[model samples]
Each structure stands twice: as C-alpha cells, then as structure tokens.
Target: MSLTSNKSSSVLSYLESVSTSDLISDPASIGLTIRELLRRFGGASETTSLTLQDLELAFGKSIALGFSLWQHMAALDRLSAIPDWLANNAPRVANLRNGSAICGLATTHLSSPVTIHGSPSPNGYVVSGTARWVSGFNFFDNLILGFETSDAYCFALIPFPQPIIPIGSSPDSIRCDFRLLDLTALQSTSTGELTLENFPVLNTQLLSRREKNARPAPRKSSLKIPELGVAKSVSKKINSALAAKQTHPLSTDFASALAQINSRITQLEAERCDDSLDLAGPCHLLIQDTLRLFALLSGSRSLAAGSEASRLTLEAMLFDVFLQSENSMRLKIEAAAR
Candidate 1:
C-alpha cells in the first residue's frame, strides 16, 4: 500500500530532525527511531508488508533508518514463516510484533559461502563459527542466524548475549564475541563481526531445518528492492538540482543519465525482473553517477561533514560492500569497466 502524503510528510519531518552525527556516535538511537516509526505507521506487519515505493519514500529521507528498518522487517518475515516456531515463541513474537524487542539478521551465509555450522546437543544445538557481518549490534535483542550441519541447513532465533564475556575468558560456555566494525557509512547500523564459540541454541529457538541441498534460492526481487529504492532517491535529488539550474552545462548529461536510471527502475518494478545480478551493475553505476553529479552541483558546500550530498554519496557507496556476494561484485566490476 502507498503511504499517504500526510504520513509521508510526518515521517520526513521526524527523520529530518534526527542528527546524523548523533546516530553515528550512538547507533542504538536508530532502534528507538525505528520503534517510533513502527508504532506510528501500523507496527510490524506494516513494515514487513511495505511496498517498494513505500520503502523508496522512506529511504529518500534517511538511508540509515531505512536500512535498519528493512533488516528488522526481513528478519520478522523469515521467522513468521515457520508455524511451529511461532507457536512456541508466542511471547517473544508478541514483543517483536509490537516493537518492544528488536531482531537482527545473520543469514548472509545462506546466500554466500560463509560457513557457520550447527551440531546437535542433548538439549538443543551447539553453533560455532564466524558470522562475518551482523548488523544492529547494540539495538537488537535477538538474532536469526542461518547455519549448516552435516546434512541440514538450519535457522535459529537466539538471544544476543548481554554483557558479553571477554574473548579468552569464556572457554566452555556459549560465547559470542562482537567486534564492531569501523564503517565509513551506515555507521548507525551498528554492523559487526560475531565470533560464536559453542553457542547454545535451545530446542524452542530452532526455527527450521531442511536438507542441505534443499536450501531455498534467494528471491531476486527482494534482493534488488533496497538498491532500487536508494537509486530512485538519488535520481530524484539529482533531477531536482538539475531542474533548479536549467542553465547549467552538465544538466543535459545529468538528465540523460537519470532518465535511463528512472526507466530501468520502472522496467524492473513493472516486469518484476528476475535477473537481479544483471540489475545490480546498472543500478549501482547509476546511483554512483547521480551522487557524483549531486556533489558537483552542490559545489563546495557538498564537501562539508554535515552536508546532505555528502551523506547520500557515502551511503550510496556502501552498496559496493553491503550485502554483496561474489557474483554481484563481478557484475559491478564488469559494468564499471564498460
């Protein structure tokens, strides 16, 4: 469903009032903002069920908040698919649905080749390995992680360690050592590396397990939505700046590039393209071009630490590494070479 103009305006105003620097220094603030947005707009269901256009509208205002919300929504969507898991964890589900408890995603391994293995134990399971990139560190209470065993791939919902023990001190017990990364952009995401050693997973928390070879393929549409959303936001900003300076020499070039990008977005949305790998390259290039033009158009002001252009530029660059797989990277590289 589309977000009404009044609702959009309210969201925009609230997002605008948030300090980017404050968010960077204290990433947990993003969770609070997300909770407020969920409450204002129809709670968890509304967030999970948001259309691409709705997401684009939100992303246009603030990428950090938008990405965080998307991640939370995605985790909820995955968890809710398992009937037994939902029935067993009703109270936790209630907290998650109402925004009282935030959930983080650690399922990148399902798509990529990262190895997080789970072994059966008497009471439940023991998971051990590294989750290369887990976002929403301080903000999330639970994490839904995907791991593989000898013959099965499993998903589990577990509580994130509170007052995590020092790395070397915890040998026998379940240990999750979180190392927050120094990110150039999306710092407010609180992305980090989690090294799990003998992590305990209770029976109640085990969501699902399927044959290793039967792991579901990633949905191309869901994979490309965020990129398209952010690209549209960049395109709109660049187009607006060009409109204001009709006499600028580069206006024609900028207009042409944005036209192609906008057309690509339209085609993908209308056709629901399945070639997300192919879509990635062009979308990334278009966003880079638009952000570059935006910076150029803004002149010296865009170089400031607090500039909108600067923030968007960095956020756009984050797509290069954020949620990227090897195949997507090759396509992006090939596209750049062209």
Candidate 2:
C-alpha cells in the first residue's frame, strides 16, 4: 500500500504543512502524531504491556518518532517502578504520562558522559548542569534526564517551562536556557542544547531504581515500537512513491523492501507475546534496510537537503539511541549498524 493510503487527511495535512525549512527550526509536528496515538492507545497504564502489533496499529493509524518515545516511557511506567528510596513525592512526577515527557537518555551530544550534580539542600537537591540531545521540549512538558553519576545510572524528572533560578543564592524557581542546534533530521522535533545553572530538583522529582544488579534467568528484549512505527510510516511513503513510478528500474527493489517490511511486521505481530527475544532484531534490520532502500529508490529526489526522505535517513542512523541502557536491544542495533 502507498503511504498516502495509510494516512488520513489530517495526518497528510499536518505532514504537508511542514517543509524542509520548517523542520530546520522545530519538529514539533511529532506532537500531533503523539497526541493521536495516545488517544488511540486508549491512554496506557502501568499494566499496559504493549507489543509491536499495538504499535503498528497505532503507527499505521497515525505516524511519528515520538510514538516510540511515548511507547517506551509508557512501557517503563508499566514495567519498572520508581524505587521507593529514590522516588519523589511530587504529584506531577507521577503524572508525567499526561505531558509525554521526552527521555534525554543517551541523546547524541550528551552521549559523552553527562551528569547533573545534586547539591544537598533543606528542600531538596539543587541540580545544576548542562544537558544536550534534548528533543520535543517545545511540546513535551518535562525532561526525563538520565545521567551517569558516581556509580549507577541516575534519572530525574524536571518539569518543563521551568523558571530560571537566580545566580547567587537559592531562588524561588529553577530556570533552563535553550540553545537549539541545527541537525540533519527530525529538526521539527524541536531538539536543542540545554544549559542548566543551579536548576532545583525536589527530592520528589528524583527517579530511583531498586535493582540488585543481577542477570535475569529468562532475559528477553522488547521492541521499540516508536522507532519501528516511524520506520513503518517512512517505508509506506517510499512504497507509494515507488508505486507511482513503476517504470523505474528501482521499483523492483522497492517492492522487495516493502514485502520484507510487511513480513517483519506480520512476524512481530504473531511472536511478540512469546518469551523469545528474536522478534525486535529482524524487525529493526528490516527497518534499517527499508530506510536505505528508501534513500536509494528515491535517488536524487531524496538528496534534497530538507526532504522527508533525507530526514528519515538521518533518523534511521539514530535508531539505536534513547533506549534504556541495560536493554539488550541496543546490542542488536549496534550489530545492524555494523
């Protein structure tokens, strides 16, 4: 099926309104996709264990990279509990789902060890540090900053649209400055370089884990549905474009790629409920290959600096990032990259 057929008018309208220039400044377009998916997913709960099929249905229903971010966080909400010792008492921290906060873990620029120091204070810990690789901040209401401290991976939830903390003594509010950077893709995501100077984090905002640091007897990897969903949408668009130009020799390759994506989606749908970890690997490989073929079949047309195809090519390269650190799936992404 052509990507056009898979999308509704509203989705198309939103996509059409964005140009390369628009993406260059902000990619908040993804918020629309996220909002639609949340509504369709019926607002996930701590118990909602979403599979690839659910993501496919949601992606096929709408579209976005935020979908994976939302899905992963939702899954974390469902699967992992904020350790009682490290848990914050803020009501908003527990309600992060309502704002669809962007997880800043492993973001590219911050991929180089990043940490926010916690200065002990009477009210809470005053965290002050700069963090980059932040996306969807313009739309997402909070920043899920994951940092490497002394021993373990520490994560925190900071409310968005934060007020600036004064330079000298502790002030009434914490402030963050944004220096948006230009990127190859997902520019519309509103990604930026964040500078935090004495940003206050209440104890209730700290996200703690209660893991014993041991291997599981039955380990299995879960799929990053949002990544796959973005890949799915891009693949359909490539399919539609290829279908329109049947006379092109690359059409055959396009057909083959589309078939492979479909096959992978079908397999994921059937096997996701099982305990085996084999499903996400092949699915990512398929999406990776699908993006490559999209660039190939689209050829010179895709070379345009701000084209959607170009953005997707960059997104495909970044597919491996932003996932949980201990996740075994990252290894597969590494292998696929190789």
Q: What is the lDDT of candidate 2?
A: 0.53
Cα lDDT for residue 256, candidate 2: 82
- In order, the Cα lDDT scores of the candidates are 0.72, 0.53
Summed over model 2, clashes come to 11
Decoy 1 TM-score against native: 0.85
Score residue 336 of candidate 2 by CA lDDT. Answer: 52
Per-residue C-alpha lDDT of model 1 across residues 1-338, encoded as one tens digit per residue: 34565566666677678776665456878888777666655354534433444456556656776777777777767776667777777777767766788788886446556468888899888988888878888788888888888888888888875544645664676676888888867788888888887888887787878886774755434534565666677777777888898998878877887787778778756644565335555566666766776788789989999798888887766678774666668878886699
Off by over 4 Å in 2: 1-29, 32-114, 147-154, 161-176, 209-225, 241-254, 264-285, 320-338
Candidate 2 lDDT, tens digit per residue, 222-257? 543444665567667777887789998767867886
Please give me the total number of clashing residue pairs in predicted model 1: 0
Error of 2 at 322 (Å): 5.0
